[model samples]
Target: MSGPNGSETMPLFEAVHDQIASDEDVAALDDWLRDNPDGQRQYLEFVDMQHEIERQIAGVFSRGPDSRTENATSKAAADGFLFPIHSVRWKVFAIAASLLAAVGIGWWGNSRLDDKPIAAIDLDASPVSRVLGIVTASENGLAYSGRRKLESGSALRSGRVDLQSGSMKIRMESGVELFLAGPSQIEMNDPLQVQLVSGTVTAEVPDSVIGFAVKVPGLNVVDLGTSFGVSLPANGQAKVHVFDGVVDAEVERSQQRVRLKDRQTVLFDGTSVAESSYDQDLFVQPGMNRDAIPTTTGDVRFLHTPPTSVRVGQFEHDLVLCFKERTESTLLETDLPVSLDAPGHYRVKPRWQNFGAVPRGTLVDSYFIHLDAIGPEKRTREGSITFNRPILGVVFSSSLLKGQNEIFGDPRTAYVTDRTNPKSDPTLENETITLSADRRTIRFSWRIRSRSDQVRVFVAADR
Candidate 1:
């Protein structure tokens, strides 16, 4: 289609839009665009329109888990317009795959090809902004920055967002994962830091990304490789709680910096900061959300493709499955058939691995990670799980796994098990069960040549 005499209809514009522009045509179009301010103005308007379309598309994908249930609208056309690539999914390998792979590099950043930016595409929570964080998980989540709402997978930039209601989790580009509770607003200062304007956010920082920080009114709490929580209540002072590892906290007004350890607390009031008693109930915990675990159906995977949902015999693709078994049980007198909660690395080895025994008075909850297989796709599969609370232990032995069929295992779940305890056979299933050093996550590799593979984890209860 052609435009009026010297606009989008120009041969040079057509060539660029068609992606057949020669070096000379590109140079000519650049020169013409520089001289024709009106032409530039008109194109800028379309870019802005495209920017809005991008936000609307993100809104479609961000509704958290609810998005899966909602029908997807017609995907926006990837015409020569600057289309951003958030990564595309290519299912199945075939001869026709190459024809369908119309992957476009960050079309949004095309205008910035040179040091000079043609026009800046600014939208609240747009992935185009300098990537600071990405929403990884949410529960009944509703967040807003100005008028734009943020859903799961929306990028957090160098702006403020008010999580008006519900809870959400963010994984910073620097690898710091934070859980934000609603009615709270936060300002990301940079890749390594954020300022809490209101509400509570708990961060789990790994060693590689040490020095990641969270700032509140008068305090700047920097993780020295730690997991910590910061809270700023409505019209209240800022409080910091270090759950594990260490944090160096500085009071802006007083110029005092203090290093805090596990279970320590710090309270800041814009002028003075002092050590305080730890409040265990100040932040989000397991069993607080609709699902006690409030998990993302998508498990974070490191090697191989992530698991997709399927039934017992439909092993068309790899699977990542997590189901809540015995939730919120204060099994004071009950002995778990099989489980381990100690923070360490342990493979699914029989007769050699250790399992933690909970004290008689401790409360407990259990979740089963089951992998069902048959036919050919019944080989090896990998997946992981992160508990909202600390884990007491994990049990995978067939005897221990089956013994709990009537206890922690869901009575309704048709769990497959051998009548006699089958010892761990490394050859049959080279399964591995490893918990992160912090005990917040468990990674496993399971192989099932028949009915199913099962692993059970017991996490601490909120009570």
Candidate 2:
């Protein structure tokens, strides 16, 4: 009942050393060790003393009972007394010491293992980027619908974004912003560079991201602290239009470089390059309420069965005018009003308010026209068209070129009228139309005669 201090109670230290302590009893011993540093040192010393006693008891047992008895007899003769070698108390003490020694050695080994240092982790070797941007907005359909779902605040990594039908906006970590139009494919190479594989993208690169580069098929467009637009169609050349500041474009194959300043435009088709006047109203900017009017130009032939209606941009233009076989007239009239939603954008409605089905093998003429959403202040209006099919000829007129109107199959190909005769050909004198190298698109620059007056675009096709 009495412990080491001669009190009428056993201490926690004695209970632990005697191998009679439960988990809760050992936990109490741990609390006492924390509050008293001298007590902790004393506990370790008691453990060492117990280990030494166990070692001595093991040595006596290993010598065997016969050897121990001989040694005890010699000691007893010298001391004039007999020693009991096989006493029960001595045997019990040896057994208890051996068990305690095994437990102490195991606990010491575990304590040594806990004192070992852990390996450190290096964060710089991580695979993920340090700062990632988020998707701000998305419209239409994503190119990679199965890869990952795109939503607001979705973190963007280095991957290709195929915008099949709509547009998307991204805000980068470096304060650079991008407005990507659909039918476009782009790759995020890093926070600083993006490769425009196909389609159109407008970049608003701030001062922080001045050197941001856009890699096209055959050229590298490096931003020089500016906002610019890059468009690359499937079959056409890549175009770089600089709205502000400067841009350096270099051909990858030829190493030919060109510097474009503010309001400058350049086109590179792998082998050749050309510069032109930058048209600001050509592309739709971010947050602009604009719509593209769809028109078809080039070889228009009547199908035996009416083809499926095609929707271009955001509107549905379903009315088809087909002329029947052996029809004397090549024209058909429609009463539908083609109303455009945007203010500055133009829409074409048939002059006649009646539409009739045309017979098979009838030739139909059409033209593709694009109107700018720019306001009236811009006196010079420009439009561009990329044909899906080959175009035989194109014509322009202030009024609808109805019956008896002059038509130009090959306009400006030859000098038909003298320069002095101004009244002879007034139509060709006012407007300037330039055709692209591919002959697929025609860029028209017209002087607006009146805001209320409408300009008509016509294309002639053979059956």
Candidate 3:
């Protein structure tokens, strides 16, 4: 392809270079490029040549000809023309200027015939609203804030955020913090209002954020300076749970209103709303408080701050400590094949592992139950823990625990696993295991030895 004056056959190339190609011209060019492979290659080569010419022309204007930036061919051409370097550049510019003038005349003639302005890139652009939010944290999640990956420091736009997996924490510019759990979809209507399409999202509104709202099916849950969680299932009704302060829930169709305060929740079945007691642990959202500790007795200590590592003999006291590890995350690999990914009452057995399968698209959180190995006493310990959520499975084998430590273990805490002693004993005869009928609690009695007795509970991350 060549310039309009350079060759009569290059009108299409000139129109494209000037950003003035019409729809029919574009269609014809596309068809030709697709049908002829050699033409496509030559077309690309022509484009590269045009770009290089454009670059050299731009340099002549921005940098004077005395700048010595032009190639040897340009210098040689100037010498052959028997003119100064500056005059040669001006001659090149004059030729380009005449070609542009011819293009303008052709566009003016077409515009008069068609009665429409040329749709070129020179048109003034329309304004766009690019709202942004800072992602404070991301945990095993894949999402997009606007057109970019939704990770920490991502700029969120005024559009829908699709959370494909795991959890994400975002703070709006208005001081509203959103804790999002996936497979979810949320639309940022503005800095204060959000629309929930499916899955779960929790918002903590500060005093500065006024009229913060979460819009779901059938109802718009508006915060009156409050924190709340909005959940909408794929094939079920919508739910709004208020953790603190007050909120006004209004139906979209009829504008029916209901005000809920601390510890109150509502279920909207697309028809009417039913008020219920708020269960804080119902949604396995990020930034949730795991205040529902189990009831324990003898040789058991509920740790508010967990010890640094789960290695043997880290603590001098011979007692078991229980703490919820972390919020729900996508389990990429399994330490031990889950025996009960579904809700059921069962006891863990040595051979039951690798016998069951975890369902696809499921998320799990872990709870660490560590029995600290004391000195040479080797005392027998008895303990029981009653959880508020359903247990998926448990891992007691030292080998399995070694694999799961980095997977589900609290990241702040370190764990020790020894490859040298892979064949060490894991189960004891004096140990006893019992899972209640609802599968929410487990009782354990282990014969403590020189090394720690560790068991990790893998539980469902949903209500």
Candidate 4:
């Protein structure tokens, strides 16, 4: 007679029996039913009992009870329902039995639904590619934007790596490796493709990754199993250099494609594209240190120049020597010991010694000497230094050595020099240096030449 909240629920029972409950009252009843599940089962049973009683009464009235015995049995049935409703224990038992029957029917219906077949579903059809590689090495101050910071052994996925400074290397899953120089942006499209937005990168593609491709601004370079380098300068020109094997390059706008073989190169601007022979010495390798020179022979001597002095009448010069053997080259520089009392005059002995059997092709030896005049005054001082090695190519910038001007040599030799006066203007001059068959040694002399405080001399030889 009382609810769990100590409020009478008799009003709720009367509203259900009348089959006319207000919306608010129905909502309240639903909440009450949730709080009291037993009450819900009892309510359902009560409603069924009321409907059965109404049917029985209607049947009796329709039949118009032909005899007193039928009328008496019908009256007794109606009275028996009243007795069960009044008895609390009997009402509980009847409600429980009805609830069990309803539950059993619901379970049977659910089982029938379960027996029906369902369409199969595939869960592994996602469209994401697998991881390709990891960042194997990274230089200090290596910053990246638009993605996570790149560190050693960081797993690489499909995304753009924008480097602000320093360099990094990536070891791919397909046995391909990449050395990405700083100030570069690259998008890892997949294991087979990369998009180079700017800067430079050297790729070492093995036989397993023959179809590896790099997409530049206006061009696409497809490797034919090669070690190559690609650079995109700020001017929007793309340059591709193939070290070994071959590659197919295509222009996106014109659909112009070309096959580049070993030691070949191509340049692609927005308006035009050009091809030429590759220069192996143009780029430094991945882990090479430009300051340290390599020695090609076992008995090679090392020299070092004293630190430039600020005192009057003091000058200094550093020498760098390069020896080429096959496709590889070795660099050596001066390693002189430091001593304040030591005389400025010193002799360097770099004898032309063949350490090993030279390959068939003409072997060339190159030397680069840099002189710096460090003194109290900014004015230039006259100085003279001599080299025993033949002078071949001379230029201010190394790029000028790419045959921009012919100075001295005829077509038969490598002794080419710039003929411009070493004074008048200190800029790079187009001068020529003559060579004799016995000219194994040469001398450089400066006489208070303006802006000659810093001079760089390049010497090359071919045998």
Top of the candidates by lDDT: 3
| TM-score (C-alpha) between model 3 and the true structure | 0.36
Whole-model Cα lDDT of every candidate shown, in order: 0.58, 0.48, 0.62, 0.47
Can you tell me which runs of candidate 2 are displaced by over 4 Å? 1-126, 129-132, 140-146, 277-282, 288-463
**Deviating ranges (above 4 Å) for candidate 1:** 1-128, 285-463
Query: Which window of 10 residues has the lowest lDDT sum in candidate 1?
Result: 114-123
Q: Estimate each model's TM-score.
A: 0.39, 0.35, 0.36, 0.35
Give the per-residue lDDT digits (tens) of candidate 2, residues 319-343: 1112111212244343211211111
Pick by TM-score: which candidate is best? Answer: 1
> In order, what is each prediction's RMSD in angstroms?
15.4, 36.0, 25.6, 35.2
- Count residue pairs with overlapping backbones in model 1: 6
User: Clashing residue pairs in candidate 2, if any?
Assistant: 324-359, 335-353
Which residue pairs in model 3 clash with each other? none
Model 3 C-alpha lDDT per residue in residues 1-463, reported as the tens digit of each score: 4333355326787788777999988886777677677777777877877875543322112223223534542654454422222323334533443455546655323222121111111111111332335464666779875566765434465567899997887766445788888888887745556778788999988653446778876688998878889888886588888888899999877888999898688999897788865655556545435544555554454543344556654443434667667644555453446434444434455454444555555577677887665457665676577777677777766666677677778775667655535444334323566666787777776776545667777666764
